[model samples]
Target: MATMKDVAQLAGVSTATVSRALMNPEKVSSSTRKRVEDAVLEAGYSPNSLARNLRRMNLKPL
Candidate 1:
């Protein structure tokens, strides 16, 4: 599975930019958002929601 770093590299933007483009569309320019979206499709990246939630809750997976 592709990671956010892969998407960022493919999109020619920073990982933070990718996160902003996905989570806060209003924060990034339309062109930037489009690039990120296209890169996501090309890279076949899917965010690991379980890992994200674990991190948010400061819990470790068993």
Candidate 2:
């Protein structure tokens, strides 16, 4: 399985940038977003849906 570090290296960005691009593309510049997106597509990287859902839940206050 491809990891975030791989994506970061391929994208020429940091892992945090990769995470932000995946989770919140709007937060990154368009060019950077494109690079990240392209890297993700080329690498066939998919975010962990369960972890993503957990993060979504955490973002919402009880």
In terms of TM-score, the best-performing candidate is 1
Q: Write the per-residue lDDT of candidate 2 for residues 1-62, one digit (tens) a residue.
A: 77788999999999999999988989999999999999998988887776668778886434
**Each candidate's TM vs. the true structure?**
0.87, 0.74
Cα lDDT of model 1 by residue, 1-62, tens digit: 99999999999999999999999999999999999999999999999999889989999999
Clashes in model 1: which pairs? none
If candidate 2 were superposed on the true structure by all CA atoms, what would the RMSD be?
A: 5.0
lDDT of every model, 2 decimals: 0.96, 0.89
Best by lDDT: 1
Predictions: Cα RMSD each: 1.5, 5.0
Give candidate 1's error at residue 44 in angstroms: 0.7
